[model samples]
Target: METKRLNKAISETGYCSRREADRLIEAGKVKVNGTVVGLGVQVSPDDKIELEGKLISKEVENIYIAFNKPVGIICTTDTSIKNNIIDYIGHPERIFPIGRLDKPSDGLIFLTNDGDIVNKVLRSGNNHEKEYIVSVDRKITKTFIREMSSGVPVLGTVTKKCEVERIADHTFKIILTQGLNRQIRRMCSYMGYEVTRLQRVRIMNINLDDLKVGEYRYFTPSETEEINRLVANSGKTMDASFD
Candidate 1:
């Protein structure tokens, strides 16, 4: 029988990526053959791997879900946090949000058990498109459109040029390729405006569509394929600093 690192074995069970498996091991939630094991521990193929006292099966299926996160729900995996996204999702299988939407802001967020794709999708340099409709405390202006689409200085650097268009007197749609913390809000604030409401409507090729707030659905086979293709060249190790 072949021997593998504990993390590799756990990841091979389709429970998570090797990095997440290492996290679980470090958290003291992973055990081998009824005994707690530390990182770098090697095990035979026949050895049993358990996480949180539950046996991890090698045949576990990967899960992908797109959720319309409503306002006030946090984009955190920590169930202990009040109104965390994971608990609200109530998925039978373990899943984590790919990225975050601020607690006060709401829209589409992807949750998945496939840890391999998370970083790729979230990598700021990947230039994947994320669309949003933002409402400001004041009416929209022509100068605002020109300056916002040009670039806005915030978060110690200028935001990348994005597509901005008026959707209403106080609402507009913007598509961004990079995400800095409170980026849109900061940009608007820098221009003497304040974001009153923000909602993400699209990420990459996916859209929130008619999915009501707080509802979720599995990605269609075509959507999954296209997503994979889009991120195929993105490195999984890079920082997903974008929202």
Candidate 2:
């Protein structure tokens, strides 16, 4: 069997994200085959793994969850205090959000144990589109729409030319491939408009139609397979860049 990165193996077991796995491993909390392991180690399926003095017997299972995140809940796994999405969902298997929508923004957020899929979905070069409906404090003019669609400077960088069309007097829909931190809000601010409300409506081909806020649904088997194919194709495309 092929050996996988220790972080990948640890994440597959649903303990935490790969980054978190590194922290645990570096802290001398993880052991493989009765030996305390270090960073950048690889493990195979036959290896026994333990964390924090306990042997982890839980077999990793791939799980995908689509959640309608309501405003206010942070999309983080640091559940040391109050409400976090992880504790809110309460899934038996540990899953992390694919990408984040800000606390003030709410909509379709994907939670899954499929680490490889997350990389594909979030990679900018993959060109997976995220659609959002944003409401501004004032009416949106045609000039403003044109300029916004052209590309606006948020902080030091100019955003890519994205699809921005008016949906209502003060409301518009936008599609973006980049998942910059609080991107939409910052973009609108740069255009001299205060975003009164923002909600992500879609992620790639997935939509949040009829899913109530705070509710979640598992991806169907066919959906899962299709997504896997898309991700695999993306991987091949990325690999060719180095050749």
Candidate 3:
């Protein structure tokens, strides 16, 4: 059997992302065959792997869920932090969030044990659309809409041009193909507006319609099939451009 990096092996098990696995290895929390291993160590599928002293096996059943995340709930698997999404859902299996929604924002977010899907969905170069409904502190204006639809500079890079439409005097909807840190919020702030409320309504073909806050449901087989087809050609590696 071919050997793989310790972090990669751990990530494929659906316990966490490769970056989180590296952190655990650096902290001496990962043991291989009863011996703690350092970063970049290689191990095979037959090797014994323990994370935080508990054995981790490759997940046999691939679980995919769409969660209606509530405001103030963080999108992280770290059990140490209070009110993390993982503890909130309390799933029997270990699953990490596919991407993230800021703590202050809420709406549709996906959780899955399939790490390969996580990498594919997060590659900004794939041009997957994420739709959001936002209400700002000030009245919506044509100039604001035009600027938002055109592009906004945030996080040292200009955001990609995307679909933006007014929903109300103070509310609007946007569809983004790229995920930047707090992209919507930063864009509004740059336009002299403060987002009073923000909620994701759709991600690709998945929609949050009628899904209440703090609720979750499994993705139907059809949904999974369609998602797989959408990301079939997306890169499995994390793209640096997304950072």
Candidate 4:
């Protein structure tokens, strides 16, 4: 195998993203052939790679799973935090969430070992769709829906225009292409409404279906194929504008 950057090699192994791998390397947590390596070091597949003294095998079985996240479960891989999603599911393989869901909100979230796909899906420039069902504190209004669908100012910038539909007196369904921090909640709050409950039902072509809270299942072969097709043209770099 041709020599490749250390971060790229680590990311290809599905252990973490290239950016995260760089952080690990810079912190002296990564060693190559029994010697600590620095950022941008290149290595062949034959060279032994270790992280924190643990051998990192180049061969890893890639996994993609859809999880029905329950409310109060933090969308993080850090095991130190109480009730984090990684600990909740307890999947034996080392996997991490593609994106985040608010702790008080619940529904579908993707967990995977494929770091490359995570970057593609999270990049706002890609315009991937994420669908959600939201319940507000009061009855929905035409003006509320109009303002939400048009755009709302939050985090120092106006949110992108999205699709919003009233589902009930106090419930609505929204589809967004952007993943701003606390986006849905912030948007609702800007419209003089408070989100009483929020649940993500879909991401891209994958839906929550009947998956129970805290349960997870691997994607079907066909589902995986279509997902790849959808993101085939997506940029691998994260958009700082959305951050």
TM-score of each: 0.83, 0.88, 0.89, 0.93
Worst 10 residues of 2 by lDDT: 234-243
lDDT of 2 by residue, 87-134 (tens): 988988768887787788788989998655665677767777889999
Residues 108-221 of candidate 4: C-alpha lDDT, one tens digit per residue: 999898877777888888999999999999999999999999999998999999999999999999999998989989999989899999999999999999999989999999
Lowest summed lDDT window (length 10), candidate 3: 234-243
- For candidate 3, what is the total of clashing residue pairs? 0
Error of 2 at 152 (Å): 1.7
Task: For candidate 3, give the lDDT of residue 206.
Answer: 92
**Clashing residue pairs, candidate 4?**
none
Q: What is the lDDT of residue 40 in candidate 4?
A: 83
lDDT of each: 0.86, 0.80, 0.88, 0.89
Candidate 2 vs 3: which has more lDDT = 3
C-alpha RMSD of candidate 2: 4.1
Q: After superposition on all CA atoms, how large is the RMSD of candidate 3?
A: 2.4
The top-ranked prediction according to TM-score is 4
Instruction: Return the lDDT, model 3, position 97.
Output: 90
Candidate 2's C-alpha runs over 4 A off are: 26-28, 57-60, 235-243
Kindly list the per-residue Cα lDDT of model 1 for residues 1-243, writing each as its tens digit: 789788766655656666678788999998889999889999997888889989876665677788999999999878889999988988888788877899999999998877777778877888889999999988999999999999988877888899999999999999998878888989999999989899999999999999999999999999999998999998655454456
In candidate 4, which residue ranges exceed 4 Å CA deviation?
240-243
Cα deviation at 184, candidate 3, in Å, is 0.6
